[model samples]
Target: MVVVKYLLKFLAVLLLFIEIDCDENDIESRVVDGQLVPIRRFPHVAFLRIVLPYGEENVCGGSIVNQFLLVTAAHCMDFVNLRRDSIWAYVGHENIDEINIIRSVKKKYIHEDYDPFLNTPISDIALLLLKEALPLHKTIQRILINIQFPSSKFVTEGYLAGWGLVDEVNETPTMWLRSITQELLDPRFCYRILNGRIPGTFCGGSKHANRPRPAMGDSGSGLISKHRELLGVMSVKSAKSPSVAFYTNVTSFYSWLVKTAQEALQSTCGHL
Candidate 1:
């Protein structure tokens, strides 16, 4: 059964970003040294933090793609170890505690091919369906997903934001939202390391510093190219400095995203 299949494996990728208390100067984007991103700059970046029934906390990122949809990484769902009822999505606020509006996730659609055990997760994307539609105002809006493959000339410096752990040793998230600009590297090498390259996946990282790799929390964080086009969700990370950050390519799954998200919004709770 799908439920059982997901239940058996716990994701190790999220653990790779476990917070360590290294000097902030040594590791950047620990949420660590990234610049504070004001709420108004990219309000659509949703804080998808979760608190387990047992009291454990998890932080992941996502972006509002429609009135009722947000795209995130499937691993953020904790390989199905986490439940939709326990997960909450926050919008219109830079601080998680000060979120302006919150919604329950009515449903989640993970790519059917997601395999938690793979060295690198393929089809790591997931779409979260909000129980209620968001009110698209100036502070909060939708980021358009990229359906066409961005050409080499079109690729730009990518920017990513999230509320992931700031100190690698502390196990606590950053006090405020943070953003960093990263360079998109060729992903063909990542495909080799990941063992398999799932369609719609790419890679990115920074060359300026070497310490911690890039991670956008658990299930999802959006990566926007220099042109501000939605590239995909930040999925896996390597602990090595100047490491590659694997992302699920938005273009590879654009059609699936549209069909599933639109259908989920149109149907009632029980209808798949």
Candidate 2:
């Protein structure tokens, strides 16, 4: 009788653990001060599923630059061991729970100059080569990368979409994609505000305070211009100022991106 009682206790504990795991999985969509994205509105937006070497999983956002290429922040690949880690990209869905087209990453290229230890992250950009080309459809399309550098005198606004944390306090990601309009601050002001931590080769947060800004997990998403051009890759948020987010200017690395993409496509061997 004691053996049977112990067995029941063990099974009950196992059931409780399973229930907790399921509840955690149900938590979703955490973009701060963002709204639900319309279905197929940002088709180029790709959700990356990254499994680290230690078996922990995380997510980052990317933009489908082409049928075979994805653009994201280089920091997302930091500390990842490709031999033991895995990455997958999901496209064509606003809700993560919905079925979407998925592709494995065959190659990853981080900028040669990217240094994670720097006080300010420059060249914080990376590209992933999909194992198979994504089929272009109404729900799956590529966004053009903007190579034109913005003038330092003017403030420009763009849209930022992601499935990052809703707020610092809540610390949870949303199940659905969310987005907000962010004003790219003037270069001179941005430099002063961020105290030279970020350079002009990057997009800084709005001059107005308390604006909706990208948070954790939003890194690697695209900063898109009004013309549907990808202007930057989400990089970092200011530690002192939570509202001030930084993005890697895509225009600064246009040449490297083109060369790397061409090389990645031509090579038969995978470059992790």
Candidate 3:
């Protein structure tokens, strides 16, 4: 009887460890139900590699705004240790392993007002200034940022591409780029679902059941409109529903982005 009791206790401890492991893995790779993107299709999509102090690496997606600037989520920069850590951007390749052009990040400009502790943080954007300017080519280019606000009458769908996890059950991120079409949701409906209003953010997701939705690792990936204009940055995914996610609206930060980019370029390149 005592032996059986001890065995049961051991099993319980083992099960607890397994649960913790699964949770960690889930948080690390959180993208699902996306289709593989064609090579050179998403030229402006950047695969960011952030190396922490102890050699630990974190991955986030970003959009190439110009030769020297790339934009991502401010939260993605929260844990970065600039004194010891490093960031690298890989562009012009659909496959993560294939390195066509690599640029090291020289500066980080996170939105000053961003607060991650908020129920829904606004201004979750950040810009990374590369040490060297990226060369434009057939498979490497910059995406145009949309300055006009999106409306239901004009914008119905947006495209999201990233190298995040394609299978949550297996806990693995795709080596190749993947993309999915998400239907934009009404702002009122999104506010209701989130239980609050996030002024500089908007919501989008798959209308059909079991369709792809942006997840954690996809944060900072661009939400591109049909006309190839960047509309949003992947921000937060709904905890209650996998089919719902929020994005930091690019249009809301257009002036800030442009002004910041101009200043940074002038300082780095001596001209804009």
Candidate 4:
């Protein structure tokens, strides 16, 4: 039977940034503040640090798109002042301390139909407007989010990484980067796990005893394929049966994405 679980809680990602320490294989997950953590764990995924006046929060994960815009989940804006200059996005930096490259949010646009309190996180995607365009050569690159049904072949047994929690709700945040592998169950099996709370969402988790699991703070992180293509965004999971996590299917929202991107590129809504 397929199992559905939320990846991590929203608060975890919204809290202070932490760094992890470990040897090559014997890595330890520690939550520390005021240190720079590298983003070498997931080459396919890019790490995004959302900065506010108080401090920087790894509140959301984003995909590189043309170096100027970072695509992320819209729910990342919850409790966040979208218009505040306190918001900043950093890309091409694995270590937060080094200050590899940073960009101010030119603007932010959330979907119109996005209801803050809906099941399945309706239209939960968001985009970060960067002050400067990115250079495609050394430090940055873009990944495509398919706007159609994803291949069960490419998606099954996929890899994902993010800065989330090491435990359940309100737990101490993970000090460093974390990641895991999971199986992409068929839609029918996934629906069974959600108890019919299916939001046209996709499913993936470790099929083996050693597969990686999403913790509390990994919300809005990307579930990526072997080719590094984005498949979904981590949104919800069962706090108890952690093995079952639910993510927004990127392919399912293709139509809306195309429209949104076009609108954002065209008018005064450059950052929306």
Candidate 5:
């Protein structure tokens, strides 16, 4: 079996604009060092269709952790409220255009300390409670969240996946899933480069020749270590040109995550 040790517990995709303090306008995120992969490779990863008054758009990415839990970045939920009937989760497909399983979102539990504009954005994490548990099988499997500190090796080398477009402004979205390998850079180094605006996150990106950073639509994508363990969720691409990006570290907020999810399920999920 292909043991993919990626990061995170339950990941859910959010379809909100990941605005950055860049000179250019309309910037989101896409795969940088990317290669197309089969939809079945990462069966646990999920595609999201966000329906708002504007319209329906397949704009975010996530992973399946257990039966009814979905994890993702807090920024994804920044613009949208925790209304139960608005969000839907898709599985058993890589491309958003094809047929797949769709489920409704029950409730969203955002971290109490999530700050989108803080000096470093503390506790940039959120959880989604699903109406139904994920169906696990050969085509769909649940991955354990990275609740423990990763080894030095896994942190330095990891894989990230997304369906964001190459050109955020002009290009169309990709029809299939894409995966890339990147190095995990120190958050302190990234802070110095970002001038202290980045926080509660880790830095990672590929060494592509022409930058080729992640596209704009992959705001809630997952970043997993080489061992197939989830390390973080895509948060921001600190650089203006989009070479490297920031992700909300999963381990740092592991304790709060479990407690929030459990409490949410008992007292909150009944409403949905």
Candidate 6:
């Protein structure tokens, strides 16, 4: 009887994997337009599409930084097995043209504390170091990380961009840029939503149903303001209520970011 039970359980797990594979395969490919039409407005921004060794496609967003580093979410790392050939990180080009490839990742560093199970949002950030410096003069550059602590007393409005869905809930993701203004929700509110757990997480966005919000495949994308300062990384959404979404507060991770960037710079320019 135990042997039969184990067999049945194995089959169930296999079936679940199959379902998820199909769901990911169904992601719609829509050309980016609308708010994204003003490419000049966000010259430093870019998107990342992670392709698994098996050729499964999982889309996440990223930003260009300097000539070699790309910043995005750590959860995106879960999509591919580490043993697989190093995953590809396409930068600069949004359209499907092969000629626009910027540079490939020579190395990737995921936050050490990242938990695959909880998919912890607090540590849900990653950095990709390109093998070659991006052609900064000819190609656009990445927006610098927002280090200035915008006082919590002042509720600042921020913006996020991704190749995510267009509706309240969508299976197809638009290629055109979609953005919505979100007010920084207090950490207290975020803790309340999480039932007082993981206070490290911060919340944002309006409760208004009509307002556009981030959806699946939007993780690891850039959230910035008019100043072009990198703000937060789109992290979690209130599953019970999509109205409340959480982002990994970039300001909270400023020290780590600076340290990481400095180390990367030294290693890349070791000869200098």
* Model 1 Cα lDDT, one tens digit per residue, 6-78: 4343122111111111233211023545678887877668888666765776778888876667888887776
Question: Which candidate should be chosen as best, given lDDT against the real structure?
Answer: 3
TM-score per prediction, in order, is 0.79, 0.82, 0.85, 0.72, 0.79, 0.77
In model 4, the Cα lDDT at residue 270 comes to 29
lDDT of 4 by residue, 1-272 (tens): 12222224312321111111122321101111212334643533445556555665645566665445566777776656756534555555454455456666767777676778875666777766665555554445566565455566544666666655555435666435556766776667666666674554776663332335675555667777777667887766654444656677777766666565555445422232
Better of 3 and 4 by TM-score: 3
Q: Candidate 2 lDDT, tens digit per residue, 147-241?
A: 46645354377788888878768686787889988777656665765677455256556555577788888899998877777888888876666
Model 6, position 116: C-alpha lDDT score: 76
Misplaced by over 4 Å in model 5 are: 1-28, 56-58, 82-85, 117-120, 197-199, 206-209, 267-272
Candidate 6 residue runs with Cα over 4 Å from true position: 1-34, 79-86, 93-99, 137-139, 152-155, 167-170, 197-200
Top TM-score prediction, candidate number: 3
Worst 10 residues of 1 by lDDT: 13-22
Stretches of model 3 off by over 4 angstroms after superposition? 1-30, 207-209
Q: What TM-score does candidate 6 get on C-alpha atoms?
A: 0.77
Candidate 1 global CA lDDT score = 0.68
Q: Find the 10 residues in a row with the least total lDDT in model 5.
A: 13-22
Please provide, for model 3 over 12-35, each residue's C-alpha lDDT reduced to its tens digit, 9 standing for 90 to 100. Answer: 533321221222232002458788
Kindly give the stretch of ten consecutive residues in candidate 4 with the minimal lDDT sum.
25-34
Better of 3 and 6 by TM-score: 3
Tens digits of per-residue lDDT, candidate 5, 51-107, equal: 666564446777665556677777667666545327787777777678467777877
The list of candidate 1 runs beyond 4 A from truth reads: 1-30, 79-85, 191-198, 207-213, 216-219, 240-242, 268-272
